[model samples]
Target: MLRIHFTDADLARTRIASAPDPLWEICASLHRMQSRQGRWAYADWYRGTRARLHDTGMVRTLRTLLLPLVPRAAYFPDFLTPPEAVDGLEAGVEAVLATGKERVRAEIGILHRTSGAPAWAPRLADPELRQDLVHALRRYHALAIAPHHDRVQARIDAERAARARAVLDGGTEALLAGLGPDLRWQHPVLHTRYPEDRDLYLNGRGLLLVPSYFCWGNPVTFGDTELDPVLIYSLRHEPHPSALPGDLGSGAPLAALLGRTRAAVLRTAATGATTGEIARAVGVSASSASQHAGALREAGLLVSRRHAAFVLHTLTPLGAALLRANAPCAEPR
Candidate 1:
């Protein structure tokens, strides 16, 4: 059984206090942006935001790749060109967020109806309005991120075709020789499925909460939290056969220092830290350690302040919990 643990308010509070960066801030800001922009370009915002949040890396990389595709005149801030060019994009994003909310309610409504719980009644009312909101968000993401997306899609398609060609060449011949008549192309041995709806909830980092009240439990009190195991395992798992360039398992002393450096930052818990101490404790050059600290700071996990020539960093509560959760476990309790 997959037992999902519920994070209580205290935990949330702790996370906020120790948070090292601005992830939530980004979410809140994005939500607010959608809300305000929804009044104008609803459609573009819906799709654009979704694209940006879901396939963030692709979206980001696309900016560079798509530069040629984008007209020289179209180069401007916020993915799309000027405001007049991206009409209804923002409103579309708002609608998608609304739609997502409705999906959650519908899922919860079904659970509630099945559970025969009276507390679920409040959530059932006007479920469509919320659902509409989520739909708006999806629409917004699609449109808002479209300018760069075309380039990304082309790049991905090209890469995929190249890989397929390589496999079909020498690779297929060797496989066919070994498998004889056992090989069957009709049944695909390799496949990939990207869950659009599920990815809608996760902000790439792989975490989101569905309100419990909408589900079988009290909508107000019983939401469920989902964590993507793939991302979690990738971020915090045993050593692998081949380590990444600067990954923790890479045997790079600088990479190893990050964990301890992060730990010291978290213990400070919003009080912040000095760059020199962070460097010394982490066993890295002050400049290199500062670079690491800057990343966490940028990621919204840590906040920094300038004291004379030195910068001090402190973990936000969220950063603390993340560090603790990612920390090496002692023993099975």
Candidate 2:
């Protein structure tokens, strides 16, 4: 009944920016996981695991798997928790299988009620199944944190109650409007599961929020991982290249510094190429490349060091990451 207009693809782009390599890797890994597990079974296991764990943060990990399926019109309320976290890989499968069975009964009850039938009939018919599911969930909780179950449950209960109060008072709306001036609202929330910060549940908006740490977790995973080509179509492509600071800025000198030749020299240097190689690559003379490279070194995009007769150029960590993201993948493997 929710009037949600956004799709999974939209969720990926806004949350998973084109620049971060780790974001791309997470998406690719999830694509493989879903293909092996089958979709419905995975979803059922995910929800039951979260309910048992009683920690919503576990749900945030799911974005790693769900990234590739962003375009699909499916709703996975809590497929964020991986099986390994709940009960190890083997136990997680068993848990999912049991939860899938209970889910069938729950779905039937909801359907019957939606048809204007007596909800009691469905509940009565599935009483035993419901009881068994509760027992299984309790078992999950036991395996989850049996040693600290009392303390953990108390915390989860408190947080759950607080979340309920926030929903009742429209806390979501206030959080979105930058209610607190010092909330670091500009920090840009990445894929996360903090109750009030989940925009999907709040306003049914396509925008996603995640912690920055999650975005930059694993960079090389993108190159080795396979992704669906369909994501290319899902992206909102720009018709023309965006202007650089020099082109878009008000001052003429600043715009001139951001010129194409200068930018290309910096970009090549960012990739660890020498000035001579950069000039050859960019179709400029070596001396011309040297001039631009020096400018970029001054601007902090390139670090130049004299090695023998050659000046070695390499990007700072920040420069390398930025360049890698904007550059095209060498070939679709």
Candidate 3:
């Protein structure tokens, strides 16, 4: 069991990540590759990734180097997933390279003690070895993760929006309580079903709630405990049926009713897209996209809100239900 003690200050400071943290996804996806624990949920992705790696001849290098560092166990080097990576992959890789030699050595030593990593693993702190690891990570991401990036982002967006609605409906406690089946929220404490018994006192530093598409089973926090507090939890697996080819074609009745451009805009809004993003996705001029979006909004299919200068468009409940009804056969069982 893992107990997280919180305070009023901590509650005030706690918040969810607006986007997927690339490094967390990388670490979690690597774990997924090594284990068949949740294979049923990710069967398509697993098969696709394996085939891609084999075709590109990256299977050997990734298994030997990267796999060792990201073993499916309690202790992997924390340096591989710095908090700064919330911004992007480049920021995360750069942070890994910029880690001080002493800190790198100390983290590797901890991994060795906990997981019995080989004696030579400590040499990863050296510049040449570190660069090689970065190269390997980039290659792995390109081969295994990049192809599914849109789907991954879509899942994250759906989860975040759901959580936000929970908060609005029942406040912060409800949001925390509904994190997952493994987590229980009891006022000032959040109890988690962890493999090891542990306690994490928030100490008013608060917690960062990160939703990961690939993180399986239980929520995970930093092993060291001294790092900025973060709870990386698995997002619920919701089938995105709109991604299917025939689901939104002009031949479909809904698409024909809405016209192909408006239907495409509505589909994109299911996972939340901005005006410009919707335009680029549907390959329409910005002005044309705006007109379609406005029509959808007038028709109660999309709700648009101003975030800074851009209008973020998301599907209304009516819109999502319509899409799902039209794509019933596309959903995973």
Instruction: Write the residue-wise lDDT of candidate 2 on 1-333 in tens digits.
Output: 111123444333332221212222233223433454233323433344457445645333343222322212122112122222233333443333344435545544443433332333234234464454334333433433343332222222322332233334544432322211212222233222221222222122334222111111111110101211111111111233222212223444333346778767756664356677898989998898888777665554555654335566765443444566777878867
**Model 3: pairs clashing at backbone N, Cα or C within 3 Å:** none
Better TM-score candidate (1, 3): 3
The C-alpha stretches of model 1 lying farther than 4 A from their native spots are 1-266, 269-301, 306-312, 316-322, 325-333
Tens digits of per-residue lDDT, candidate 3, 155-264, equal 56666766676677687887898787779999889998887899999999999999987899888888888999999999766443223212344434344335777878
Instruction: For residue 326, give model 1's deviation from the true position in Å.
Output: 4.7
How close is every model to the real structure, measured as TM-score?
A: 0.23, 0.23, 0.76
How would you encode candidate 1's per-residue C-alpha lDDT over 278-307 as one tens digit per residue? 777667788877777776754545556543
| Cα displacement (Å) at residue 178, model 2 | 54
Q: Taking the candidates one at a time, how many backbone clashes does each contain?
A: 92, 10, 0
Q: Looking at candidate 2, what is the lDDT of residue 172?
A: 41
Report lDDT per candidate: 0.34, 0.37, 0.80
Best by TM-score: 3
Better of 2 and 3 by lDDT: 3
